[model samples]
Every structure is written in structure tokens, then in C-alpha cells.
Target: MHPKKVQKLIYFVFCCLFTLPVLAQNRVVTGRVTDAKDNSPLIGVSVVAAGSATGTATDVSGNYRITVPASATSVVFTYIGYTRKQVTITGTTLNVTMDAAGTALNEVLVVGYGTVRKKDATGAVQKVNAADFVQGVTTNPLQQLQGKASGVTIATTSGDPNSSPTVRIRGTVSLSGNSDPLYVIDGVVGADIRSVSPNDIASFDVLKDASASAIYGSRAAGGVILVTTKTGKAGTPQITFDAYTAAESPLHLLDFADRTQYLQAYQQFYGKPMPAGTSTTSDQGANTNWFKLITHTGISHNESMGISGGNEKGHYRGSATITISKEMCAHLS
Candidate 1:
């Protein structure tokens, strides 16, 4: 053969020798990954061949296929909020069940000046997520947090929707009857909770003991309520709309003396038939239903719109809310 032809033939033989072993050593492994607690398939799980970069991710159905080299003895599976697992390769098919990682204990709490894991925190703290908030037409955000946290009492002075609910932590802590907990919004001390719409709230971290005093001073004597509003998330821009309407009316009315009953009572007290034409400001001779005349069905509505989105570097969110409420008491025209 010619010198150039001989060189080309040798190069082709070397390429085959190097590629054949790699192709033969690689094997395809397939399996499904699921949650151990509920046995639900877990999507987006990362599956990597042990000791090699060869890896793949579980699809929407939680099924995965990876090319494992002969040098790899196992495969690693990892996902957020789940325990990492590794399985020895015994055959072409491998199934894995992943247990949930520490949920409550592993929660990252937003405390004063920093974050602390719930398991490490020594103070009496409770967290209420947005998903757990009360649903209804609410004029105040605190109303949404009612009955969600322990050691917290939330009540309104009346049934009027305009009135803000009073929040007390561990009952009345003051002689002045002002048991409002200190409001901390996004690291701003004494921020007004009303400024943030209920639909914009992300979560509430309530510090319900004397330990809170160390952070916000005596103002937190009743307790400390840390409010974290929703912010933009890393994803496509999202627009959300929330609205609710409530109708209010008195369930029962007090039974009072009507014209006939009042006349009979008067006659009984006087021990004779009352004189006729005894028309006075009190005796208008009209059996008017004062309860019906003074009250009517009231309506309350709340509507909110928000938009949020961002990338890994930063995010932004903005929202607006409109609320209209009317009391049951009818106005005499």
C-alpha cells in the first residue's frame, strides 16, 4: 500500500479499537421513582450513574432511562424535599421509593435578622402558610389568619366588616386592654398589616412568647407577628385574580311588644279599658316592625389582582385590591 493509504488504515483501526469497548461497556437501565409516603410518582428527579457523569432525569411520569457504564456499581437519585437514595445495579430494571425529608423540622424559619431551622429554634414560634389562611370576604388581613395559629385569639368587636379584628397572643397581657401584637412586615418593625392585601400574603410567623420581646422589645409584650408578603418567583410571568362576595343579615331579632300587646299591658296596669284616642309619640297606632324597618341584607365584596415573575437574580411582584362592605343596619331616610 501507499504511505498515505497505510496511515489512513491504521487510524481507522485505532478509532474502532477505542470506540468498541466504550459502546460495549455501556448498558441502559430503566426504572420509576416514587414517593415512599404516598407511592406517588415523583417527576424531575435526578438520576445519576454512580462514579460517572452519565445521568438522566425522571420525566413527567416519573420514568427514567440512563446509560450506565460497566465501571458504575450503583445509581443516585436526588430530589428536593426528599431523602437522597442510591440503589445497587442488579439488573436492567430498578425501582426506587424515596422517603420525604424532614418537613416541619427542616423548615427554614424567618426570624429576626436571620433564618433558623425550626428544629433548632428554642422560642415558641408557629408558622401559617398562605394555603392555610381562612377563605372569605375579609376587609382586614388579620381576619384571614384567624384560628390558624395556636396561643392566638382573634376576635372582632362587632359583626361589622369594617372593624379590624383584635389579635391577642396568650390572652390579655396588658391593663390598658390593648393586646395587639407587634406587626413586623418584611423586616420593617411596626408596619401596618392593613397595607398588604390578604391575597398578597405569603406566610405568617408568629412568635408567641416572652422570647419575642428580646427581638422587638416591650412592644412585643403581647407577642410578635411577622408578616411575609408574596414576592415574585423564578418562572414565567404569572397573573392572578381573586374575588369573593358575602351577604350578611341578622339571624334572629329580639321579640318585643307590638301595639296590641302594649295596649293590653297598659289596660292591665290601669285596671280598666284604656281611654280611646290616646294618641301620643309612643302610641302612633302603627304596628311597625322596627327590626325590619331598621335592618336589611348587607353585601361585602373583595377583588384583587397581582402579577409576579423573575429569574434567579431577582424578582418583583405588585398587587391591587378593592373592597366594598355595607352593614346590616338600615338608614332611616
Candidate 2:
């Protein structure tokens, strides 16, 4: 072919390459984060692109907006005290609901060294699901158990995150010996439930009877608390992501005594007169709203990503999670 004809062919090829479909790949995803059990909106939750580190947080109304590159395929969602979820984006918005860490309690419970359906349980066992243990943001899993389960009482002697609660089952059966029930995780006896992340748990079972406790022998004298973590199921390789953000504040505040009120009360109770010319009104001190000063609607966020895929030989599933909470106001009125 002539040189001019060859040059024309090269230009045509370049034009074709430039004109070919640009890989239909841009997307924008929007969604709201909510509690799976109650469907309550979770504000300030975090949402992110898996493996890319790109992310955004929910607003006060549980709404979130994110723009992903054409190469992006999946997004992860997470919040404190809730299971993380992963989702693939096909449309413009993806509404997500996150189950509380332990809400699956009644669905499954531990029996001896094995597991059984909660409904088929033969002994008197109280089951607490993940939701029962997670409500707002909590660092300690034991705190979530307080007042949530029947026949179980958890008391916090000190307001410390790492401290274990004084757990009692059906009142104190022993006076001097250990009163707390035996904690088991998976098949291991005497396990600390706190060691496992709240988001990692699938369910919790409480064995509370002599017949139920007999299997473990002496270890079950105080009853038993069983914990089960999440696992993979039979299927093709799949990815799931869940994220959420929430703004938390004190539920209520107490009334405070003003300077005048304090001085009058002090004078009446202690028989001490007010200092000369020290007008209570003059030194009323700034009307400090202690509650407002100590409380804040800080943002709490969480994200979880999981991948599962295998063949007939075997299966595998791996998951990772991240949770973050902004500093909160600690003072009440």
C-alpha cells in the first residue's frame, strides 16, 4: 500500500480506539443507616469503599452520600455495637440495616459442647440476642447485658471499660464461692466473652438449670453463658459490607442549684450567714449549663467488610471491621 494510505489507516485505528465504549463504570451511591431490629435511623455512621480507603460518614439523619470511581465495585458500612455489612452498588441508593451484635441469641443457643435451636432447648435457658447487648455505642460487651436478659443481673462496681461486671444468675446460690456463671465461647470453657468483638458475635445463649449445667460438671455450678461468632455459609465467593454513623447525647439532664439557691440552702442548713456585700445575684456565676457543657452529639462510625468464596473441596470466609467514635460530652446537669 502507498505511504499515504498506511498513514490514513493508522489514524482510523487510533480513532476507533478512542471511540470504543468507555466501559460503563461510573456510579454514585446514597443510603441511610438503621438498626436492623428496630429500623431506627443510625446517624453519623461511616461508609467506605472496600480496599480503597475512600469513605464518608452519615449525617444526623442517618443519610450518607458517596461518589465512587468507575473502578469501584463494593462499599462497606459499619457502626459501633452493630454487625458490619457489605453491599454492591447497582443503582443510585442502597439502604442498609445493621443487626445488633448479639440479636441472634434466641435463634441459636449452645447446649453442652454442641449447639441446638433455641426453641428445641430442653432446659431452662435464657437467650439474649446481639441486639440486646448493643444499643448505643459501648466499649465493654458486659455493659450491654445489663437489664437486657431475664434471670441474669449484671452490676458495674466501677465505671471502667475493661472492668468485668458482677454477673449473677437467678440470685446468689453461693455465699463464699464464685457466684458468676461459667462463660464459654465456641467450645472452650471458662472463656471471656469480652475477648471477642461484639460485632464478631452471632448469638449468645444462657444455660440456667442443673440439667443444663450438669454437662460441664463443676464448671457449670454457677450456670453457663455461651457465645458464638459468625461464620461463612456454602456459596460462591461473595462480598458484604455495612457501615453506619450515629450522633449520641445524654438522654436527660438533672436540675442544678443556682448560687443564690445554694447559698440560702447552705445558710439554713449550716447556720452560716452570707459574706458581707457578696451579693448572691452579683456572684451568681455564669449560668453554666453543666449538661450542655458535658454532653455532645459526637459522631460514632463503623464499617465491616467480608469476603467468602470457595469450591467443592472446601469453603472460606474472611471479614474485617473498623469502628470509630468521636469524643462525647461526659457531664450531666
Candidate 3:
């Protein structure tokens, strides 16, 4: 071929290679979240991309703007005390309305060996939803009960993970015979709330007062804690996973005497001569970092996975969860 023809052919090949189409870039998405009943804007609502970490929250005015990958097809909206909603986006501008979450008043509440409605209850009772449990912390479910209900006090005398907290409702009513409430899990008595995984709990109900406690007989004086495990729902199989990892360290440390200072003080106070090879220097021969040698940051992790679904007959649900935590203490000696 002629040189001009060859050059022309090469130029055509390069142009074709460069002309390949490029993927579309993600666009800015904006929207407003509001309550379905009142038409009032919802503020500080969490708007997240489904199955991903990309998300943002609604501003004080209930307005939200987020940049999502072009591949995102759906987004999830959630707020406390509100039902979660998922929306498919086709354009930049979206408007959403969320429904109020149903409570025990609309659902069933477990009582002594039976169930009842919240409005008809004649006892001092409190209920907590499973969805409200902390996702990734090693703390017990009772720890989350603090400030969640009225007239319920859960105090942790010590920070031991395996230790149970003291739970009191409307003050203690018994002088002995177990001042703590009776724990019932899934219709079984004497259940340890700590043993059951928090992820497995569907709901928790606290029964107080004689009207509610009388059903349990002798076990009622201390009150009652009822736990219900998650059950299956009818529909397509749905899977959910929650994972968390955390590290905790002392924010402040108290200053104390080092080995040399301690030994010197001992000798001076006792009016005894210094040991043969002992030095009075403030800096000990070998740096003894008491805190470093004795203590380290605590680490905790939790993982949970659940599957729910059903056919025409009935629903089936299953879940498993594991959590581990290690806490180290500083040796004052």
C-alpha cells in the first residue's frame, strides 16, 4: 500500500478505538421526606442507598440531597418511630411520605401465659421493639432499655459484660425472695435475657403491678420481663445482616508514682538505708509503664444474619448471631 493510504488506515483505527461509548456519570438527587398523615416534613430522616453505605439525612427543613452511583436503582428511607420505606428512583426529583410505625395498641402484647391489647391492660407495662436494639454493640439488651421506657431503671453496678444489671420498676416491692423480676422468654420461665441474642428478640414487654403480676402467682411480686423471638413473615425470602466493631479506651488516666519513686518513699518513710544497688533517680533503670503493662483498649464485635419468608401454608424464619468482647483493667500496683 502507499504510505498515505497506510497512514489513513492507522488514523481510522485510532479514531474507532477512542470513540467507544463511556458509561453515564451519576447525577445529583434531591427530595423531601414528609409524614403521610399530617403532610408535615420529616427532619433528620436517614436516606440510604439500598444494600450499600451511600446515604444522607434530611435537613431541618426535611430537604435532602445525595449523590449516588448511577447503578443504584433503589433507596431506603428510615426514621425512629416510623415505618421504613423503599423507593425506586427514575429521575432527580423525588418526594416521599412515611407512615407511622404501629405499636402494641395495634398489635398483640404478650401477658402472663397469654396475650392482650395495650389499651385494655390494667398493669404498668412497657414494650420495646427488636428493631430498636443496638446493631453492633456487646452490651446487653437491658442496657439499651435505659431511658427507652417510663418508670424503668436499669443500673449497671459494675462494667462486667457477664454481670446482670439491677432492674427496678416503680421501686422495689419485695424485701426478699428475689427482688428482681421474673424473666420469661418465648413462653419459658427462668430465662436469662443475657443468654438470648439481642438480634433474636422480636419484642420485650415489662409487666408491673398486681393486675398483671397476679397471673404469675408468687413470681409476680418482683415484676416480669417477657421476651419474644422473631417469627417468619409470608412473602419473598428477606435477609438482613448487621455487623459492628468497636474499641474503647480510657479517656483519662490518673497519675501515680513510678517504681523508683515508690521505693524511695518507702525507704525514707521507714527511716531505712537505700538498698545496695538501688538508685534514687526519678527515672527508673527500666521504664515500668504500669498502665501499658496492665491495661489495653477493650474490643467488641457483633454479627447477625436472619432469613424470613413463607409460602401459602405458613411462614418460616431463622436467625443466628455471635458477639465477643474483651475488656482489660489497669493494674494500680
Candidate 4:
């Protein structure tokens, strides 16, 4: 053969070798992607042939058709919020059923600036839902969180009902400055916790480490408390009412000496009869049970009402709460 003819023949063989694979990939594979739980068609699902760059997406009807090489044995299907699926190409028709992904692990959490999935959150975060709140009358919203979270301390500084509870996250950090964690309610920084009733709250997201300082700055040196309130949902009008009443009484009373016992004790100690008009005012003939006069039963009552409704365009929610508490010796003690 001539040398020029040989070069032409080699060039033709190389082109054929490259084109043969492309020509052999003409096998058509059709399939439908549907949710495994609901059997509903899933739209915008990605369909790709195994070990090949050829891919396509399912249409609105969740129907997909793709061309694959004859050697391709399996096809891959993927969709957002659904698990990835692989189907064997037994024949030309390849149907795929995808299961929902993430389950409870995909729950969304509200951070300082944005939201993150529960599994994706790297910081020390704890979430408390209203459903888990303590069942009973709560003088303050913070009281409901007592003993619910780890590495957190909630205590009342005094018995005063109006006093806010002392909240310490991961123990106290500051010696001079305020050690209380920063409170973020409904995206509002430094909002007073007293303004929000426990009945109106949906959840509490507590960032309990230095990671919180990165989001809220130095004030969050102690930690951060993110409060998410309840909002309206897309549904018919709904109204709710809640009310409760509680009574409190002193568990024990201190023992005190009567007039006769006091006189006898004073005589025994001083070796003399009690002097008249002494520090002992009982000498003036007044026998008063001060403890009995000062203390009484305390009563507390609370009521809450809320209404919510909306449509696809917008939603609205209104809520109100009333709390009345009268404690025994609240001012005298």
C-alpha cells in the first residue's frame, strides 16, 4: 500500500474507534420518579446513567426519559428533600421510588443571624418546645425552663413574683460585669423576657457556649437565649383559651415562747423577775400572735386567649394573657 493511503486509513480507524462508543449509547431508558411514602410524582428529579456524564431531569409529571449506553446497567435518581435512589436497568423501563430524607434530623434551628439544620449545627445548642414545658402555673416564663436543659441554672433570687429568675448558662463566667446571657426574642435583641408570656412562646433555642459570642458579641459572654414566638398558620380561624388557678400556703411556722414561758425563761436566765417596760413589750399586757396576724394564704390565677388564621397570601395571630397573684405576706416579709 502507498504511504499516503496508509496515513489516511489510520486516521479513519481512529475516528471510527471514537464514534463507535457514541453510536452504541443510543439505547433509550424511560422511567417515572415518585415518592415512596405517598406514591406521588416528584418533579425536578435528576436522572443520570451510571458511569456516564449523560443526565436529565424529570418534568412536572415526574416522568423522565434518558439515552444510555448498551453497557449501562443502572440509572441514578436524585431529588431535593428525598433520598437518592438507584434502579437497575433490567429493561428499557426503569421506575424509581425515592424515600423522604433526614426525618427529624433535618429540623431547622434559628441562630443569631440565620437558620441552620439541627444536624448541621456545630455549636452547643439545645432546643425546648412549649409542649415540653412544665405543666402547672408558672409565675414567670423562665420558671417553666427550670431543670429542662443541661448546663443551665434557673433559680429565683427571691420569693417575689415580679422578680425575674436568675438564669446562668454554662455556669457564671463574669465576676464584675453582668453574667446573664443575652436574650433575643423574635429576632429583637435585648428584649425583656417578662413581656412574653409562656403561653405565647413556641420554642426556645439556647446557644450554650463560646460559639454564641461569635454571633451576639461580648454581651453573650455568658451565652445566648433565642426565643421564637408562635405564629399563625395557613388554615381556618382557630381560637384557644387557657386558664388556671393555684393556692399557696406556708409549709411550716417557727415555734415561739408564750407570755408565761417567756417570763419563766427570763427569770431563770437572769435570776430575777422580769422588769416592767423592758425590751419585752409583752410586759405591757399585749399578747399578740404576730406570725398568725402577718401570714395568709396566697392565690394566683392566669388566663390566656389566642386566635390565629390565614390563607396562602398572608396570616395573622393575636394573643393576650392575664395573670393575678396575691401572695401571703408579700410586702410584710
Please, what are the lDDT tens digits per residue for candidate 2 over residues 1-333?
999999999999998787664534446789898888888899878899877778999998889999776777788998876788989877788999988787554565567756677788788777777766757655556666678778888887753445687888888979888878898887788888668655667667778888777788887878888877776667767898877787766677888886778778878987879745666465544457666676677677877788876676777767776767665656434
Query: What residue runs in model 4 are displaced by over 4 Å at the alpha carbon?
Result: 1-46, 50-67, 71-74, 83-109, 117-120, 158-160, 275-286, 330-333
Taking every candidate in turn, the Cα RMSD to the unseen true structure, in Å, is 13.3, 26.3, 25.5, 6.2
Which parts of model 1 have CA positions greater than 4 angstroms off?
Answer: 1-105, 158-162, 266-286
Query: If candidate 1 were superposed on the true structure by all CA atoms, what would the RMSD be?
Result: 13.3
User: Where does model 2 exceed 4 Å of error?
Assistant: 1-110, 113-122, 127-149, 154-166, 175-177, 264-292, 327-333
Off by over 4 Å in 3: 1-110, 113-117, 131-136, 157-163, 258-289, 330-333
Query: Residue 194 in candidate 3 has what lDDT?
Result: 85
lDDT for position 129 in model 2: 75
Q: Please give, for residues 1-333, the per-residue lDDT of candidate 1 as tens digits.
A: 899999999999999999999898999999999999889999999999999999999998899999999999999999998888999999999999999888654667766557787778878888899899998667888988899998899988876655678889889998975678899998889998878888888899898887644677788888899999889999999999988888988999988888778878989988867647665456564588888889899988888999999998999999999888888996677
* Candidate 4 structure quality by residue, lDDT tens digits, 181-232: 8999989999999998888888888889876447788988989988888889
Candidate 4 TM-score, true structure as reference: 0.74
User: How do these models rank on lDDT, best leading?
Assistant: 1, 4, 3, 2
For model 3, how big is the CA root-mean-square deviation? 25.5
Instruction: Tell me, by TM-score, which candidate is best.
Output: 4
TM-score computed on alpha carbons, candidate 3:
0.55
How would the candidate models be sorted by TM-score, starting from the highest?
Answer: 4, 1, 3, 2
**Mind giving the per-residue lDDT tens digits that candidate 3 earns over 1-333?**
999999999999988776653225455789999999998999999998777789999998899998877678888999988998999987898899999988532555667857776677777777888666544464676876666767778898866777888998778876765778888888888878888766667778888777876778887677888888877888889999988888988887767776767767878998776666766566533557667677789888878899989988998888787778777675464
lDDT of 3: 0.79
Q: Considering only N, C-alpha and C atoms within 3 Å, which residue pairs clash in candidate 3?
A: none
Q: Estimate every model's Cα lDDT from 0 to 1.
A: 0.87, 0.76, 0.79, 0.85
lDDT: which is higher, 1 or 2?
1
